[model samples]
Target: MAKREVRETSELRAIVDSCQTVRVGAVDEEGMFIVPMSFGYDWELDESGTPRLTLWLHSAGAGRKAAAFGANGNAGVDVAIEMDCEDGVITGPYACSYSFAYRSIMGTGRIYPIASGEDKVYGLTRIMEHMAPGAPQALGPGVLDRTAVWRIDVARFTGKQRQPKA
Candidate 1:
């Protein structure tokens, strides 16, 4: 498979940027890869290093995701966020498809379950922020207790982008 070039610093960060929600792919012991769900980028970068993606994952309390993770601790993940370009365009009819179609993102990271209480709380907060951009959302009481947070330390991330001429 060919790799895409990484440009525009913001593109690199934009993948996990203000945009929330990402699909996580995990492999099962049966050698089957299953997409757990659509998680969002909870936290960005901190004093530690590269932005570690924060996710609010939910299992049936137990299911494919849980089993897959158990089989292989080191999981493979892929995320793609697509924006609507020219919806519909035609010539004679009256419309012509024309819009910008660009995507900047990369996949490949190590999954490390949040351990520290503070970090977990921080990550959870970030998740909420991503979900509700500028909305005011306060934790009810102990919302953290029921939720599980996973942090993906971006090992290798690269993306490519192209826009319509001005």
Candidate 2:
């Protein structure tokens, strides 16, 4: 419901920035699959300073994810940051109260494999920075050759939070 929705752009960005991993959803010949993956992202700005979010991910050159991309480039992604939880509190005599507090962002986007060496390196660098800040920025050509980098240009997204009812 709207009461649970997070409408501020800054808040949504915070949720994304706080999370280290994203759940990527895609469909294949067999069926659908949702997998957790490490990711890096960039928030690009337009002339008016509006922000555009794009996610970067990496994987082996060949595999189920690669195959799924080949079949369908469309995908959905979710990033969640759990803030806290409450448990074992008896709200009623008959049952214990349980609730989780978390902030999350989810959206649909088109995934594409980055083919240009320079672009791939840039994306990979962002990924490394997010996963391991202060780590090496340089990625060897051999390593790049063995890795497949992908980008998701998010078209639409929404943020939501569930908190303990006051």
Which number leads on TM-score? 2
Q: Which runs of model 2 end up more than 4 angstroms from their true locations?
A: 45-50, 72-96, 164-166
Residues 75-144, candidate 2, lDDT per residue (tens digit)? Answer: 4322221221222232434444544567778787777888788888999998988889998787655987
- Pairs with backbone N, CA or C atoms under 3 Å apart (clashes), candidate 2: none
Question: What lDDT does each candidate get?
Answer: 0.51, 0.74
| lDDT, residue 135, candidate 2 | 87
Off by over 4 Å in 1: 1-4, 34-61, 70-100
Give the clashing residue pairs of candidate 1, or none: 21-40, 22-39, 89-96, 89-97, 90-95, 90-96
